[model samples]
Target: MDWIQGFLVFLSGICALLFLFRKFFFKSKLANKKGCDHNCDCH
Candidate 1:
C-alpha cells in the first residue's frame, strides 16, 4: 500500500542520514593513533 512505501522511504532516509553522520562526525577505525581533531602537525 501507499503507507508501506512511505514507511520504507522514511526508514531508508533515516539510515542514510545516520550513516552520513557517523562518517563525518565520528572517527574512523583506520585512523592512526593521533586521531582527527587532535593536536599535531596536521596544519
Candidate 2:
C-alpha cells in the first residue's frame, strides 16, 4: 500500500513538471505563425 502511494505521487510530480515545461516552451512554439514567403524580410 505504501509503495503504491509513493508511486502515484511520483507519477503525479512527473506529470506536473511536464505540464509546466510544455506551458512555458511548447505553447509559445505553437502560438507563433511560420513565415510563408521565402523572400520576406521578417526572416
Candidate 3:
C-alpha cells in the first residue's frame, strides 16, 4: 500500500539522520582517553 511505502521512507529517513548524527555529532569513547578497562566500549 501507499501508506506502507511512505512509512518505510520515513523510517529510512530517520535511520539516515541517526547515522549522520552518530558519524559527525557524537564523540567516540575510544578517542583521547586513558586507562580504559575491558568493561567499557573503548575495548
What TM-score would each prediction reach against the true structure? 0.60, 0.61, 0.58
Worst 10 residues of 1 by lDDT: 24-33
User: Residue 30 lDDT in model 1?
Assistant: 27
Instruction: Quickly count the clashes in candidate 1.
Output: 0
Q: Which number leads on lDDT?
A: 2
Superposed model 1: Cα runs more than 4 Å off: 27-43
lDDT per residue as tens, model 3, 1-43: 9999999999999999999888653345344354555644553
Candidate 1 on 1-39: residue-level lDDT in tens?
Answer: 999999999999999999998875444442445564655
* RMSD to the hidden true structure, all candidates: 5.1, 7.2, 4.7
